[model samples]
Target: MPALRALAAAVFLAHPAWADTATETAERAAADLREAIATLDQAEGARNRIAALTQTIRAYELGLTALREGLRSSAIREDEIRASFEAQRDTIGQLLAAMAAMEAAPGPLVLLHPDGPEAAARTGMILTSVQPALEAEAAKLRADLQEIARMRALQVSAHSALQEGLSAAQAARTALSQAVQDRTDLPQRFLEDPEELQALVANAETLEGFARGVARLQSDIGPPMEDFASAEGTLPLPVVGTLLRRAGEADAAGIVRPGMLIATRPAALVTTPWPATIRYRGPLLDYGNVMIVEPAAGYLLVLAGLATVYGETGDVLDAGAPVGLMGGDETALAQGAGAERPETLYIELRRDAEPIDPAPWFEQTREE
Candidate 1:
């Protein structure tokens, strides 16, 4: 039983878990890229086309990122295995050479040697004791060889995945560029002076004040030409992430707010999930950077906590057009310090100044 346990331990130690992890990561990245391509192929209209293309680009980028990470991980594992094998190289070589010498001298000859009966008997007993240990060492060597082979294979697979990811990303980018050029009918509900909007956002004391100030600016652009009420339960999220907070949830200060928070990767691209005109894009209150997009008649979409703002106040953005990016990296200033925190975006949907739950507007399956 102890011998069996030792063998099992040797096998376990020979095979590192990083190889499996890298393979799984590669598989997942491939799956994501495939899904992205499928989404783009299925898009029908300009709005859907832009959205799908944007999503495909994002997916390709993410897939490439994951593949590169997997490649790095695989390389590290490979180096570790090589180092371990090199450390044992001399021992394994000596064991093999000793085994070869033993094979050249038969057991019967060693036992019947002319040295003496006592010496031959002692030699036979020593061989008997060392044989099992030698066999165990050989078994461990075989295991190590197998593990090295597996690591090499994993490295090859990682390299292949990286190449595939790069190719797919390049193709996706090309398609995205073409799609952007083909798009023409993006709706624009309101237009505001960038300078005035920036000043208003900078001067606003609270979110409510910011919202009101935006409402005053939008009063001149006339009502939305389209209705967003019919699009309930179907709108895709602006970013790919996990929902952290729901509407009316209490914050650390115990104050309930009417918005949802999404936790996403650092510097994740933010997009308009629907056709909207940019109303405000700047700092407001405690929110780092905010973008107010009006997507429909009498409705405002407030997306805050961004590290960087992209479009100006008057720019009309179609669904999935780039708006800004989430904060967390060095390029985008982190809002909170001391410890690393996951990038989070606060989103709210408002009808004329009143905050409403945006949960019902988006697909339930996507919220997670």
Candidate 2:
């Protein structure tokens, strides 16, 4: 199957399960991970190795994310089933005790009631009427037990696949970084003047000022990306993550910023949302490993909090090309340690000196 289709299917694998859905979900996740691993291995020979590796990483992420959610949901179901069993413990005990009584009675006397023949007949009638319901409950018990076992097996199997996928993704990232560096064929629109950029960064007081300064430094000989302005509200998010905060949304400290924040897994791939020229890429002020690119004459996109950056000043990047990877240990997400290794990417869109809400530009950013 195609990469995006695989990811879409994998992401939904963890949706609410019934009798056999959870097991099938785990099965699909495992298969998807294997496919992603295969893709990683084949990426080296692909013409566009960077794009291949990026897709591979995303495949692993979506599968693992779905698998994790499925695991959590399965656990809840297991707990509920156990609780249900526990809550009926007294009833179960009574049933067992009744069975023991029947077993202890002599075979010939089993159907006999000490009271009389009429009472014995009524007793037999009651037993006959209740047998089907009892059998049904017994069958349900068997099914629940089997489901619990299957879920446990699913978890056990997912762990090794998770670890393997994580390791492969890490290696892919390392290779991708090298590939981006080794690449020499990308077109350059203009080279940034180091001194001019340094002066701007040094004098800039806020993000808006820095973005404006970068825009002023851009002197691309080529025309801006055609129809870039018309591409509004159609661009996908540069990375896969949950929207942590919208543009101008306040943080925990009640501080509002122009950029939006996204919560991603460790070492998540960050790509260019559109074809753009790298205006500047490096640590500036407090933003760590920032990459500012101009997708149009007056529009600049700022991505910060990346662990490693790719491309150099003036190199033109195709839309969806890998720009960098989010910071954090890649294995941490699979180990259920994401809370301890939370990685967030800050994205800001600037039109000239004014900051604009990125949600209106990227459709995924508006997802609640």
Candidate 3:
């Protein structure tokens, strides 16, 4: 009887001990989304609207990522719980049938055991013992059913929250885009002539050649960003993403490039890591849309692979200024942020026309 009772208890509480951690993480993720929503609301009145919107968009991204992970854990846990029930289906059916048969029989009939009075008495005791175990298991089963319902509700609500966040973020993007366009307060380092840039672009055969041409075009760009050399290994990544490659590493196509690649979410915002003058901002050979900024006179930070580029050539931009967005369908993100990161940003740093490893400059995103 004890053996059977233990088995029933084990079957009833089949979820692994680790199940609560996932549930708690999911609850915390819900709280994070709530705070992100509040941040979005607070952004409306912030003095620096562009920076505010950038922060808000980032908050939503972090919240959504955590929630997505939570959802995945919840799904795995649910599958484990259901699988437990499925495995014990026969045992549960037998237990229920015995209980039903015992309930239907009269006391006298049950006492009339086929063997004898002594055997009948033993049978009565066993049935009485099983009663408590049966009740306990029934209660546990009810709890599990409730848990399944709760998970379903959580999933539905999480999806709803995701859609709302995505829509709000898109609105923030549009607002930020307009804000960058209307602003005229930024310092213009020098004037750019289209004819000159076109000629440079047409003549250049390699990135090194193109970059050298860009460096030579620098006019009296006032003063360069102060002490850019000292900022190495401490700079924030221009966008929120996971570092995919370091300089000299091979990429998906097995092509080695003197740049680092970062995997980013769809329509993810790209910002400047430091105050710098825009040397060039437009399409370049091989690379898609590109923005090359001069953090200092000889130091150029090149950001490539963008859907849309912002800011104009020779315009000085402060740190965290919106530079561009990674290419991806924004509407698809609303369905659910895909497990795969579809966008990639390529970053390269050069000093005095020599390629310097960009990894040393962006330690922040590297750790993440």
Clashes of each: 0, 0, 0
Ranking by lDDT: 3, 2, 1
Candidate 3, which segments miss by more than 4 Å at Cα? 9-14, 34-38, 41-45, 91-143, 193-198, 215-230, 337-341, 364-368
Candidates arranged by TM-score, highest first = 2, 3, 1
In order, what is each prediction's RMSD in angstroms? 8.5, 8.9, 4.2
Question: Best by lDDT, which number?
Answer: 3
Scored by TM-score, the top model is: 2
Residues 1-368, model 3: lDDT tens digits: 56656666665566434446566687689779868977887786788887898888778877877887888887887887788789889887766775677688898987788899998898889878777877777776676777778788888888788778877788878887887788787788665655767799888687778877877774456765578888887898998788888889887899898888888888988888999878788888877888888888788898999888888987888887889988887566657655564699999898887888898788764443
| Candidate 1 per-residue lDDT over residues 94-121, each given as its tens digit | 6677667777986568868588999888
TM-scores of all predicted structures: 0.55, 0.84, 0.79
- The candidate 1 region of ten consecutive residues with least summed lDDT is 330-339
Look at candidate 3 and give me any clashing residue pairs: none
Off by over 4 Å in 2: 1-23, 95-122, 192-195, 219-221, 224-226, 336-339
Compared with the true structure, all predictions reach lDDT values of 0.67, 0.76, 0.79
